[model samples]
Target: MSLINRLLLLLLACAAPLPATPSDLPLKVGLIGLDTSHVIAFTGLLNDKDNPSHVPGATVTAAYRGGSVDIPASINRVRGFTTTLTEKYGVRIYEDIAKMCEEVDAILLTSLDGRTHLEQVRPVLAAGKPVFIDKPVAGSLKDAVKIFQLAEDAGVPCFSSSSLRWYPGVVEVATADFGELRAALSYGPATSEPHHPSLFWYGIHAAEALFTVMGPGCQSVVATESSGAIVVTGKWNNERIGTLHGIRDGKTSFKVTAFGTKAIVEQKSGGNYAPMLREIVKFFQTGKPPVPAKLTLELYAFMEAADESVRQGGTPISIPDYLRRHGQTR
Candidate 1:
C-alpha cells in the first residue's frame, strides 16, 4: 500500500467511534407488573437522566401490565401507572410477558399479588434472564420454594427482597457501629392482603430488616397477636433473638434496635429505593444476584412460620418443620 493511503486508513480508524463495550452499552430491562408504586419509583430512578441519584447503564425499555383484578389497590391504579410509564417515560407496553422478555436483557417481577409470581416468573426463568422479584416472593411458602427451585433448575440467577433490607440506617447495624449483633427488634406497618399470608404482604419489610440485622438461620418462630398488632419472635441457630412487630392500626413506623457486643444501634431513619436499585443494576450487569436465593427462601420461611404460629394460637413453630411440611427440605 502507498504511504499516503496507509496514513489515511490510520486516520479513519482513529476517527471512527470505538466499538461499544459491554459496560458502555445500556442494559434493556423489562418490568413484569405495574400495579405497585415501585414501578414508578424504580423506573424514575433508572430511566430519568435528570435525577441527581439516577443510576445509569440500565433502562426500563418495556413493561407488562399484570395487575390483580380482585385487589382494589392493584386494579384501580394499574391503568394510570401503565399510562404514566408509556406517556411520561416513553416505555413500550406489551400485553404478553414473553414478547417483552424478548426485547430486554433483565426482568423485574413487580406484580403486587404474590399469588401470580410463580407463573409470571416461569417464562422469564425459561428464557434464562436474570430476574429480581419484589417482596413476598410468593403467596404461599410452597410456591416461594418452587419459584427458587425452578430458577435453580433452569440455572438462572434470581433474588427477592424488600427495599428496607438495604436501607442505610438498617444496613449500618450490621457493621462495626454495632459489632456482632446479638439481638434486634424491628417494627413496621403490616397491612394484610386477603390473598396472601398476614406477614407476607407488608410485614416482610420489618421481618427482612430483622433478618438483615440478625443474619439467617432462624430455628423457630412464635407469635402473639392482639386486635391491632402481632409480635413475632425468631430464635436463630446461634441463639440470637430477633423480634418483628407488625402494627395494623394507628400510626406506624419502621425502627430497629440492634444490641451488639460493641455497641447498640437504633435505626429509625428509612432509605429510598435508589440504594437498592443500584444493587439491581449491578446484579443485572454481572448476571449475579445481590441477595442469595437460599437466604430469600429462609426469610419467606420465617414469615410462614410466623403465620403458622398465629394459626396455632401463639405456639412456637419450628422453621425446619415448616419447610419440610411445605416440601422444601433444603
Candidate 2:
C-alpha cells in the first residue's frame, strides 16, 4: 500500500473507541530527571492536568532529577519552578530525594542518557526499587552492566526502551514468521556532533529496533570504512544485517526487512516516543520489564564493539569479551 493510504487506515484504527479506565491500577510514581528540559516529557505526562489519563492514580508529588545538584537552586529555585509546573502543568514537586523514593512505589529516570544517569540511577538501585530508565542507560559498557546487574542482584524490575520497539508496522513484520532470514538494513539520522559520543548516544536507538525485530545476541561488528558514520553491521541469530548512516540531515526513520526463503516483508516506522511511554506504563501494570536486564546488557556490548572497531582502524570487533564474559548465561 502507498504511504498516505497506509496512514489513512492507521488514522481510522486510532479513531476506534477508547476504553474505560481500570480501577485496580498501581498508585503514585517518583520521577527522577532534570526538570524543565528534555526530560520534561515525563513531567508533561504525569503532572500536566491537560493530560488527565496518564496522570490518573499517579501523582509525581516528589520530583528528583537535575534540580538536585544545585543545592540552593534545588531548594529555593524549585518552589518557583514547581509553582509553574503545578499551576500550569499540575505536577507537584518534592524536595526530598530519599523521601520521594521511599514514598512512591516506582521510579522513572527521565534523564535517559549520559554519565549522570549512572549516579542518578545509583540512588534508585540502592533503595532496591524498580525503575524505568530512559534509553542509552549508560554511555559506557562497564557502567551499563554495573547498573543493570545491580538491579538484577537487588531483584528489582528495571526496564528501558525506545518507542521504536512498539512501532506497529515493525511489530507486524517481525511477528509474521517470515520463513528463513537473509539480510536487513536499518538506519536513522544524527546531529552534526560526530565524536560527541553520538554513536553511543543515538546509534543504539536504531540498534534497539534492529535487535528487537531480529532478536538480540548480535556478534562481530564492522563500521563503515569511509564515512565512519557510526554504521554497524553484524550477525543477529542466523541472519546478516546492517545499520546505515547516522549523523546525517533528514527526518528520523527506521526500517526492518526479513528476507526469507519463502517471502520478504518490510516495516518502516518514524515515530517511537508514545509507544515507549505506553510500554513503561504497561510494565507498571504488569511487573515484567519489556526488555530484560540481560538484553540491555547485550545492547551495551553491541555499542562497545562499535567503539572497539572504530579504534582498531575500523577492524571488525568480536562481541565475545567484555560484559559478554560476565553477562547472564541463563
Top TM-score prediction, candidate number: 1
The per-model lDDT (C-alpha) reads 0.90, 0.64
Q: Candidate 2: which stretches are off by over 4 Å?
A: 1-26, 35-38, 46-59, 67-84, 192-196, 225-228, 249-252, 324-330
Candidate 1: regions farther than 4 A off: 1-19
TM-score of each: 0.94, 0.77
Give the per-residue lDDT of model 1 (tens digit) for 1-330: 999999999999999999998779889999998999999999999999999889888999999999988999988889999999999999999999888889999999999999999999999998889999998899999999999999888999898899988899888765547667788899999989878999999999998888888887899999988889989998997788999999999899999889888888899578999989999989988878888877887888888788788889989998888888887865
lDDT of model number 2: 0.64
Best candidate, lDDT: 1
| Per-residue lDDT of model 2, residues 66-96, tens digit only | 5544334233454455555566654555565
Task: For candidate 1, give the lDDT of residue 316.
Answer: 92
Q: What pairs collide in candidate 2?
A: 33-65, 34-66
